[model samples]
Structure formats: C-alpha cells, structure tokens
Target: VSDSGLGFSHNRFIALIVSIAFLVVLFEGASELGGGMIKAQVEQTTSKFHPEKNAEDRLKPAMVLATEANIDNSVEETSEAVAAEWSAEGSCQQVIEGNDMLQFNLKEMVVSANCKEVTVTLKHTGAMPANVMGHNWVLTNNTDFMPVAQAGGAAGIENNYVPVGDQRVLAATTIIGGGQETSVTFSIDSLVVGDDYTFFCSFPGHYAIMKGAFKVI
Candidate 1:
C-alpha cells in the first residue's frame, strides 16, 4: 500500500533558507567590491598630473630658499630639535631691534625644523647708526654661540659682524642700522629637531646680552 505524503522536511526547509541567505551575502560583497574598484579607477583617471610637479621644479640647487616653502607640519612643530641636527636644519626668522643701548627686543627665539626654509628679519628701531649700534641676528647651538660671537667681533663692520664660513654659525642676517631692516632665509634640513638652539647677535660683546633660547615646537 503506497502512502501519499505532503509533508515538508524541516531540515530541507532550513537548508534552503540558509542557501538563499548565503547567496545574498555573497552577491552583496561582490557588488561592494566592484563599486570600490570603479571609484578607484575613476579617481586615478581624473588625477593624471603628477602630484609633485612643483616640488620637483623647486628642487634645483639655486632654489634661493624661500620663507614660504613646503616644510611639513611635523618639522615645524619640532624646530628646537633641529638645532643640534647640523644635518637637517630648519629655517628661522627673528626681528632684533638695536639702539645705542645695545639691546634686542627679544631675549630668546623659537625655531621650527618643520619649515623647509626659515627667515629672520632684523630691524633697527633706534636712532643709532650701524657703525655705532648695528645689530644682526645669528643662530647656533648653545655651546658654539659664545665662541662664534667672540670671533665675530674681530670680523669687523665690513663682514656685517659675521665671521666668514664659520661652521658653527647656523644662520645670520645682515647688520642693520637704526630705522633699517634685513632678513635671512635658509633651509631646515641642515639641522635636527628636539635639540638645544641659541639665537644671538654676534656684535663683539653682544652675545651675552643679545641671546635667547631657540625652540622647535
């Protein structure tokens, strides 16, 4: 006797549901992957030009070291460390005011190594002439500052109170007289970050009186 049955196996029904769920998941994943690939290809097609074109052009030896160059933010935040670097130096800018009293407006300066180039401006706000009370901005490691300043005294007025080719000298500005101004811009790649730095005036006996702590951050 053959028995007529119209019963659905519960296991088979559960398996069918699972298979459908798996298929749905697989298709969704593939679609997402395809969409991501398409977006990436579109972006690549749109950005055909080289990203570093300007940077490559400015990399010549005679770049003149502008103050507004592309020094990354990480370097600027860590300027003081560059003072001891001697190899990866940063650019700095300072304005020093000189009068007959032989003083600077600032006692110290902070430098950032994150700058591709640094610029320091020296302004003489007093009535004294360059021959009488000239002031110039100078930078170096704390240890080398005093010696370099002492030697710069003998360099005389013609040398702008700066010694020629001094290895210890990191950066220097031209001497400025009262109501005059000067500025210097240099690269930061010559110094390291997180090291002690000093900025001063090398005008004979000025280092002791015209100096300040240089910071990177």
Candidate 2:
C-alpha cells in the first residue's frame, strides 16, 4: 500500500509539471501577438501625422498654395494699374454741358494727341429756347477766340452761329435749345501740342462766361 501511494503522488507531480509548461507557452504566444499589434498601430499613427518620409509629399501642397496666392495678388495689382492708367490718360471722346446759368460744366478740356479724331458731345440743360438763350460749342486758337466768336455772333442762329468756311474755327457744334443734344467730330491733325486753345459758346454774348481752356497733350 505504501508503494502504490508513492507511485500515485509521482504521477500527480508529473501531470502538474506538464500543465505548467503548457500554460507558459500559451502566455508567451499571447504576449508576442500583443506586442506585434502595438507595433503596427504605432507605425500607422506616425505615418498619418508625421509624413516626413518623402520631402515632395510634405512640401507639394504648401508649394501649390503659395503659387495660387501669388497669382491672385499679381492679377489684382495688374487690374489696379490698368485702371489708374485709364483714368490718367484721357479718352478721345468727351462730354460737356451748358445750363441756364450760361456755365460750362468743365473748366478745362483735356485731349490726347494720339487720337486720330476727337468727338465732343454737348448737352443743353437749360429751360429756354435756342433763339432766346442759344448755346453753341466753338473751338479756336487762343489768339483767334474773340475774333472768331464775334464773327460767329454775326453769322447768327441761321448758320448755327458758326461763320461759313472760317479757317480759324477748328470745330463747332450746332446751337442747341433746352434739353437738346449735339455732337461734333473733328480731326486731331489740326491741333498743336502745348498750344493754347479756347472753347466757348458763341450764343450772342455768352462767350465771356462760358469758356474753358482746351488742351491737346
């Protein structure tokens, strides 16, 4: 009975050792798997946030954004420059007006010498008839302004208040009444740059007050 009890205890001891070995192997395998999973997760997070793997991949988007910003700024500056140039360099066509007070709206008229032909639009914003308070736009040199105006007054409204075949008259628009509009096209070849010129209304005696400097530059 003593031998049998000893054998049974030995068997139990061997079984316990086998079970312990199996448990150790299982735990080691589980640890290795968990470590591998953690390594993979860390790598994935680093690649997503810190993409310093390739220089091109990191800087391409930034470069594109900067280029677009530069292009937009260039377009805006170019537009502003073009607008300023247009405002400084007068155009070939202009408009002027005469009201009941016998005053021209523009104190000075600017003309571009580069224009082949210049057009002048005149509007009568007065409340009187042409025969009563007539207004006609006449262009002449400063030297011939008074004489041309006098001759035009003598010409009368029948001839649009402009002398017939007068060489001193550079251009003239017809006499207009209230709410009337007239325009005249004249060649720029006859205009001299830096020369003094005068534009006035030759309506009876309205030249003195209704005149302005006409400049060709």
> Whose lDDT is greatest here?
2
* Residue 207 miss distance in model 1 (angstroms): 1.5
Top TM-score: which candidate number? 2
lDDT of 1 by residue, 161-187 (tens): 888999899989888778998888877
**Residue range 129-209, candidate 2, lDDT tens digits:** 999887888999999999999999999899988899999999999999999999999997988999999999998799988
Clashing pairs in 2: none
Q: Report the poorest 10 consecutive residues by lDDT, candidate 2.
A: 81-90
Off by over 4 Å in 2: 1-90
Candidate 1 regions with alpha-carbon error over 4 angstroms? 1-94
Superposed Cα RMSD, model 1: 18.5
